[model samples]
Target chain A: MSLAFTRRALLKTAAAGAAAAALSRRTAAQASGRVVVVGGGFGGATCARELKRKGLAVTLVEANAVYTACPFSNAVLAGLRPIETQQFNLDAVEKEGIAIIRQRAVRADPQARRVVLEDGSSQDYDRLVLSPGIDIRFDALPGYDEAAAGTMPHAWKAGEQTILLRRQLEAMDDGGTFVMVAPANPFRCPPGPYERASLIAHYFKTHKPRSKLLILDAKDSFSKQRLFQAAWQELYPGMIEWVSLSSGGKVIEVDAKTRTLVTDFGRHTGDVVNVIPPQRAGQIAQAGGAADRTGWCPIDPVTFESRLQPNVHVIGDASIAGGMPKSAFSANAQGKVCAAAVASLLRGEAPAEPKLINTCYSLVAPDYGISVAGVYNPRNGVLTDVEGAGGTSPVSAPPSFRAQEAVYAEAWFQTIAREVYG
Target chain B: MARLASVLTMGGMMSVAVVVMVKTMPAAAQGVAPPGATSCSGCHGPGVSDAAVPPLHGRPSEEIVAAMQEYRNGRRPATVMDRVAKGFTDEETRAIASWLSQQP
Candidate 1:
């Protein structure tokens, strides 16, 4: 079918289907129950939106009135995109019949089936879904604490810190050294550090051509390492240097005043330091008693129900989802799956088996991108990667192909944002 | 005696087959969406139309199934679909195609 014709037909069909669903939902609304969602990022927001769409009453408790996405925050840091582009209001979510509470969730009482807010008020729920993303572990690195973060911005959460990092880069003189300390594995966004390095390099290449970037990585290998390295060599040769853990790249301590990084083997001084510390489940997860010794909540891969708490499920970065890295796309997918499970549980039905998929794209430059895609299935109580299903972008792809991937990457961000927030 | 024994065995097998069919028909009718299909909505579902990625909804089941098989088999050129199509088994692909075919 012609593309235009197909789009028109699909729109008509969607409108008809929506009308039918709305009519049925109105009749079924009498039996629907309340679903309380904590955190308002990709996973929580998507879950809340999906539940509300299904005629269920949903309450979304988020500390921030506006959510700034982390997916493309690197672009903001590099001055390629404005921070405002990453920020979203809750108006779209509110229009979907979700009760938006702009207050911090202090605790989750599973036994009481209620969540306490910072204001001392508690909201009762028939079911609770937690999508609180992650918390920085200050103790992971000695001398690297919350206070240190102001001087050495991580900018991982995307907001004021992002602006700080951008301003620091802009202020640095030509030929100055920029240093980045990457986090360990099982953290949010495995390829994030490398992408940040690439974008920062891009900035320096354009404005401060004589500047240098040093990356101190915790892990020896990273997601799409070969692709990133190749792009760096081709795009900004001699401008970026990556030090692996085996080569004393792991930063064990930091001095914010001196702008120094201490590793097991040696110490390095730089003009600008970006320290991304280790991470754990968001504090509310720990407060709720959902997190375990590992500092992440264990979940049933099929239903995302917390092994620690009944009727309270955790998704996104806080949940130990097997074989699924913590990415916005993964969280978005998990959100939909969890929403379906929560809906089924509310109706006193068995949750269906879930198949999950994730595709993460990283931009090395404004016009160069690469991606990895995977499909997963719940097997033996854990999500396992389906063999022969997903793969990374071809290593030998031409520049034109890479540029096209970048376009798709931006489109994906736009589409996902609409899906989750709207 | 031989003829009588053969007839009894055939009758028993036929009755079991009928019972199995009766048990499975309802599940087939109430078709649950297979895993991984919902994720497609992020890019290929509603509110996304870039011409690079085609819409999967409202397509014929046979057409959808054929396209996926081609992508999986490397018979079709793709930017990312080939990698994505490999993630599903033929049966899973069929299930996804059937689900999408029924969608508006």
Candidate 2:
């Protein structure tokens, strides 16, 4: 047969096969097959919504009934926005014929294609999407745990703890110390702890001029460090202090009860302690053996299928998609791509692996903002960085650029929220 | 020979479809390439010089790939490029970059 005939025949056969698989659902609801998505954050939410739109039966299991986003949680910590701004009900997702389960996923039986819930309930699926977000490693840091969080609020999850940390800031006396401990790299939102520190400084400048903010960082340098340092010097000098990992800035232990954080250099007492501990894949992903020693799941970039198991896809922060940072935008993009691949798989077609996009925005101050964005692609089982794809905040940008950045920050938040929750 | 011409035409059309799909789909679906490497020329044109977009002629492959990646994300801030770069795999990025870099 001619090559033309061969190509046409292949396309026809593939299309027919896909159609048959899609239409061969066991039940009326399962005609497109069952897709159980663990976690209702950016990645899971986007996948669930898109898969549902594609005529798939989606079941989204989340630990919290209402998702309090970590995206805008910084505003809550800085007292600029309320916690309600970040709180979202899963009503929209549920309305899309998705079975929203409000319970923690305990373990996943990859071999059996089933997930076990904290309530001892077991659910089955033909394909599963896991985007369970991040889990804090309390044990990684001595004297830091659930008990420590009571006094030293991580505020990383961004809900009640954000408010608690904010309240602690409010009650501090003028000239009181606000200590922030930032974790090393490969943590959720590389720019988060720095952004939090910047926002707090803004608050101090306006509300408590005499107050001081000290950052105890685990890393030697930070994302957008030049911009952050420059802004801090220009806007809030003497009001903020940053100690690097080499400069005795590392936190060795914390006495949460006394609000004292001990470092190699010395011990310091804080009126408010904001500790963002080291993070890993959410407990469910780790427990399922989807995660590796690095505390994240390894997946085939083409299909987002877990490296450890067949027929299971891990997306978002849980998946070690190299070169793609763990951000809401990255997770959202991965979620959609993975959903398409999953849908294609059920239809007995190969998933089309696509490029991924990520952009992270930080509020350097109320009117000033900075960001980094990149496009990533998978090569040889690793996501290689697409060089020259994105750049850091422009050096010495004009006020108008900064002002526009502030507006874009708001718009970007709304855009991602719509993409995930709308 | 008629069959060969028909096959080539179909390949061209599929390349266009892939470009349209990559450019128009949301940022997540950008990097996926159609079955063969020939589809690249459909949008890029037979080398950068012939394409509607800027010719990739003689540019460093790494630089070209970097530029595409930037365009796909909001960082570089190019409207058409962002659409074009979506859903690309790393291997595909390198392949396209190498192809454009090698074009006369």
Candidate 3:
């Protein structure tokens, strides 16, 4: 109901581009209005920071003071890197003159254009950006409630569960079997499950050479499947086995207490069971009525404005961006596009034609990396992958090529992190 | 004025200035960031990044255009640039490069 304006709300932020100057001139008083952003991940942070950079009143709402990034949290699972390396703060964002709200957004009222926080206060916005990332559908998956997640950690959201899964693997016997249930498609990070399995297998090959990784996948195919399978054979030979959907890889139920997973055809019990359950848009996105029947937000490809809700732009894993995998890279690109679009719309103009690019790098081993790249063009509000551009890494590339990809993977993470967090 | 312009363009950059037809360019692409320039920061790294990929900021527009053209025509080898280069036309590439050439 009330506008959540902090002391810095009226601060003269630096770096207002010429475009913003023209936009403010065109729209007059309304151009520099409030743009409240929810969820402070790659997508939200970039969008909020960009909006502020354009001289708009911006507020970033995040539940956590420190963000634990999911991009390279896999390395932390292997003990190759510490969790601290994956953690980042919003100090850089705050310095840019955007107000940061350290409270969970419990609800969003689209009619009022108000975002109500858990503490009962709300922020009204001229344009609202929702980037709440993904929320696991604990109810959709049988026997996999929020409580069950404590026993059989999914490690999908990173941070606490990542450490849990890794700690469990460390405590298991050397010959112990580790079963990981991969979720279905349209989920965040298509190559994540395979990458986690590979990294965990890498840890095993060194500390527990006799250990095995059994991946129960919901789909028959995945992003860069051939590259991942090839790397698995070359590096962790006979240490990993994959069961696809038709082979009864879909888990019907999970018993966290027994560390067991039940599929339609068989039951699998492991020393450590990791169930990556089905996922949908975060609760706040659904609460805001941004999501549709698909349980994901359908957005205009150019503007990222929710098709279901007016004036609310959804990005990151929450929105169903066509041809773009739900990746941090895609989110960052979309966020930038959306910021420009929002700024233009505030001045009552159609957004410019947007060109979005996404490159997702996955580490098959610490030294072996693979990627899937795509460039998308939005035509008639639908995004199509540009012809003759962007595809998977060379499946048959030499070890040297794989090693170079691994180095680039680390660099990509660092580059994207700086672009968003700073 | 000569010193400032020289420092800003870095020599090769000014050559493209006349070729760039800013009047004919799309209004949205006129400023610091071009049509797809912001997308580059997602991977190429932002300012002063030691992040493996070469920073495109402050590079000469002509050099950037040449590299992109080479990548597009398969004359250059790259992990991802080859694929990305094909997405942009020579005009759009020049527009993006010109913006990067002026970055501080």
Q: Which candidate number has the best TM-score?
A: 3
In model 3, the Cα lDDT at residue A294 comes to 74
Q: What are the per-residue Cα lDDT tens digits for candidate 1 across A247-286?
A: 9899988999998999999899888889988999998899
iRMS (Å) per candidate: 12.6, 13.0, 7.1
Candidate 1, residue A109: the lDDT equals 93
lDDT by residue for model 3 over B9-99, one digit each (tens)?
Answer: 4323433442344324444433646678788878765354333566666556898899899889987666678888888889999988988
- Position A396, candidate 2: lDDT: 86
lDDT of 2 by residue, A214-256 (tens): 9999989988798888888988888788999999999989888
**In model 1, what are the clashing residue pairs, if there are any?**
A355-B35, A355-B36, A389-B86, A389-B87
Poorest lDDT segment (10 consecutive residues) of candidate 1 chain A: A12-21
Deviation from native of the Cα of residue B71 in model 3, angstroms: 1.2
Which runs in model 3 stand beyond 4 Å of their true positions? A1-32, B1-32
| TM-score of each model, in listed order | 0.87, 0.77, 0.89
Scored against the true structure, residue B62 in model 3 reaches a CA lDDT of 92
Alpha-carbon lDDT, every model? 0.83, 0.74, 0.83
DockQ of 3: 0.34
